[model samples]
Target chain A: MKKLMNVPNDVVDEMIEGYAAAYPQYVRICAENKRSVVSSKPVRPGKVGIVIGGGSGHEPAFMGLIGPGFADGAPVGNVFASPPPDPVLQVTKAVNGGAGVLYMYGNYAGDCMNFDMAAELAGMEGIRVETVLVTDDVASASKEEAHRRRGIAGGFLVFKAAGAAADKGYALDDVVRVAQKANASIRTMGVALSPCYVPQTGKPSFMLGDDEMEIGLGIHGEPGVKRGKLGTADEVADSLLSTITADMPLAAGDRVAVIVNGLGSTSQMELFIVFRRVARLLADLGVEIHRSFVGEFVTSLEMGGCSVSVMKLDDELAEMVDHPADTPLYVQK
Target chain B: MKKLMNVPNDVVDEMIEGYAAAYPQYVRICAENKRSVVSSKPVRPGKVGIVIGGGSGHEPAFMGLIGPGFADGAPVGNVFASPPPDPVLQVTKAVNGGAGVLYMYGNYAGDCMNFDMAAELAGMEGIRVETVLVTDDVASASKEEAHRRRGIAGGFLVFKAAGAAADKGYALDDVVRVAQKANASIRTMGVALSPCYVPQTGKPSFMLGDDEMEIGLGIHGEPGVKRGKLGTADEVADSLLSTITADMPLAAGDRVAVIVNGLGSTSQMELFIVFRRVARLLADLGVEIHRSFVGEFVTSLEMGGCSVSVMKLDDELAEMVDHPADTPLYVQK
Candidate 1:
């Protein structure tokens, strides 16, 4: 649970200041609200603005995803906590253009309520704002309760698609449509080998035995399928993907984008090993991996674990997924 | 000390397989030797080939640094252990286009000896090869013994400059010169908060108290400056930068590129907090930060800490640093 920080109270503020300074070419802090981080690149006058945000522990999610072809603005929260409505409103206003704006975030209760409130405020300002709740973590609920599932690393793809739509000058409604469609087709499941610490707190947020691991754990160390004896990379991949494929039902000839995302403390070495198993399993099922992303896209402090997210791709989704993105942490051409 | 892998002995082999599978568009294992990972993008005829490599465990260093506009090939070794001369020879043969090949790696004793042998073999085969040994880790030795200093994350910049030179059609000697200049201008220092366990050993590589940290730690568990009570991020960054600036003697009106590198388990949040202090310190000295890179550029398994690297930039080095590179773990335009 050790951390390298100054005063715990100053963690978020100082971190954001450092982030903006480190990535001056890509991001800037909002003048109205210090917590709101926006792309330095301006959005066109009539283009729909894409705004994505969530808790602060997920570094690249809310912050790293803001750039030329991704989310236009991001309102960062305290670690594992949702941002207040004011920052969200600030981000919405900053990124808003003549075509209105779209708000995308994980399907957490605090986030939904705060974002809805911000949307209402934006509406009063004559800006048409829409919301796309990313409910892509299949492990959070049964398939029958898919709408209730929480979002995890799979939201990376969901936001990527919406970002591409906004960058392509899609209308607000179209951007929301693409985000929702991407969310519906994506599923993620994660395993936690250890717990993480919140900066303000000096203790672990949760607990796990030395020889135990939680399959399908939430990003913030929420209960998973079950905490059991630790398994090998292959076994963990099989468990997570089996549940995901069962829920999404990928058949032969289906093309998909695979993300073997490290939660926090896990290394790329281990993530790629898990990805190797994921590739073999999918090939056995005769599914084609159109694209593969293996690294820490979304994280939870320094938690030790990883997640596997698969987004079933079609013509439109594939094109959006292939769109260019130039962000602080992620760049593609 | 828990890990996600099938077998201890198979860690390196399987990890390489996973890396090649995850980035099939960018890399492939050489047919002659599975340890040799070469770029999928073919090097043009008469272009000086960039062959970079070292031990495994540092996932993104050798492996991730191979792609378009980067290293043409990388011969991966077992965890924290150097590769034999054979794989290096295979990599030389695979990347040798017509102008010959350039070997770039850290200045470890094993790497120097092994790569030297490979260069001798390539010369016997009539392929002229030159080398640039990276010795940028200022913590390893004093300025008087700078040539004996080990390379750390600063090797990332050295290799990057050389890669751009090769991609820009620099001759073997020219690429070697660029890499050498980049190495001479760069300096790096690191701190370790805890120990990491190798897959095969299943034991901590070194030891540290719960409230202790080792300043000036190397990539492996090599001896560092000292072990003492852990300090705040600001204090640590100050200490590291003080030593580095004292060694390099940067003055006003100087421009430099900085890298705040996470060893392994350290999160980006902490790294940026560290980078924020680094920015402030450099600003106090009236130094211009040409660019800043804050993330896991190089690592040591799941070690918990970070390193700070700064490279003095002239127009030539700046262009080489800013050149486009497409790699699995890193990308830029």
Candidate 2:
């Protein structure tokens, strides 16, 4: 229970309060639905409203991405649990600007169930809500089962492209097409050297021996494909990237955007070390890099590891990916 | 030591290579000095050049801040060790821009000696250089000896003010004055519940019993003023904010910018919990918050703790603080 929190049950409430207070210009807690965070910027009419949500603990993921050029709203949930249909429906309705609403999030069972229910509810009200599930964690499944792969850091690329598309006044179907393409083109894989604690349990969700690492752990401490002694940053990067590129069969002439994400406890210095290897390996393969991002975009609360995500880009995807975005946690100009 | 690095001795070099590769648009390693990181943007003549540096563990601090609206260059060092004079002198010479350069860093003995020597060397070459040491950690010393206090997250404010001032084309002396004023107005304090391992040492730097926390700990695991059972986020925020306000004697109606900085391992959710209390406490005290930043701005490598910094603001300082600055880690527009 070494976490700096109040009563374990109150962590989400207190965190939501703090988040709204800290970034008043960018977001505000939804008055109609306490669990939803809404962007402060006015929604433009006839623009596809972008809504993203998932479990808590992965700060700056679903909530921090809410702004003018990003998600219009995010329904926050309890730690490692999906937001219920009530809040999801509330947020979808609140952000609906007559063009329709798009619900985007990681591909998880609970999230899939809840968001589906929300979409049905919105349909009853004639809101025309669409959904895109991100499945980019290459290590989560075999190539034949790519649709079953879990989403990780690669969700960031999906959000960026979809948000940019919606901001461009694209129709709901067009925005959904862009989001699905972004999700399909991205791949991510991660390694874990340490476990994260759950406040409710007051203990680590999993365990690893000293000097050991897991090759492909999930954000919620789900079992990975392998566990062994920790290797150097270069070795770890090679293993993850090889798993990813093999799954996608990326070509030498492909241009990609790269992201080296820290899973909470990993230092940015270590991420850069990993990124160095990623860049060199891609260069060796003749895969050109269009842009690169390195920092804590997706995280497993205090879990020690890093994830690398690569998104193959075409001209349309490249333009949307490079579009300017300004949010509390991310900014591009 | 669960760190992702190759041969601990080569960590710094690898990190530098990776950083340059990851952020080619923002920075590049100095050709003449391998340890220096220079901004990719061209320096405008007659503007005071800003050079910031320190140890290597605090990622996105010294290096991430090098860009058009921030530092011009940063001399890299080994983990938890001050950089030598060679890289400092080289960076100073390279970013001179025919005007002058301002050297700013935390108030530390090794840094003091090294930067002083660099200034002397630059002086001999007719490259005018001034130094401003940030002393904002209120718990490091008594108010009577405030100048002897250590710098922590508050140093970010000093860098922001100085960078904005220099970007405004202020003379070297004027930029120095603005930096000194910012240093004087800011205060910071932190608490640590776990220790960080140094890659070179292959073990933790310090130890804390389970369920215990040390208040006012230094960035390098230095001893704090008190040790006790870990408390709630609200209680911890109260303890830290009370100490900071008392030392500065901040009065009602005072406006300030607040930063709830994660040392390294603390989750952003916990940071928001602490910040919720910070905003509530300040409101209760009748103090107005102009802007707030909550994240890992400055960090100890994987240390589980957080620091709070407050900068009392006047009109000039407020405007400069809000001025747009674009860097790899920070951007305002």
User: Candidate 2: global Cα-lDDT?
Assistant: 0.89
Q: What are the TM-scores, per candidate, against the unseen true structure?
A: 0.99, 0.99
Clashing pairs in 2: none
**lDDT (Cα, 0-100) at B106 in candidate 2:** 91
TM-score of chain A of 2: 0.98
Q: What local lDDT score does residue A138 receive in model 2, on the 0 to 100 scale?
A: 85
lDDT of 1 by residue, B1-333 (tens): 798888999988988998898888999999899999998877689989889889998878988888777889999888988899999999998899999898988889999999999999999998899988999988788899899999889999999999998899888888888999999999998999977888888999888778899988888755468887889999999998998999998999999999999999998899999999999999999999999999999899889999999999999999999999999888997
- Candidate 2 lDDT, B205-287, residue by residue in tens: 67889889999988876657888889989999999999998998778999999999998899999999999999999999999
Q: Which ten residues in a row have the lowest lDDT in candidate 2 chain B?
A: B220-229
Instruction: Calculate the i-RMS of every candidate, to one decimal place.
Output: 0.8, 0.9
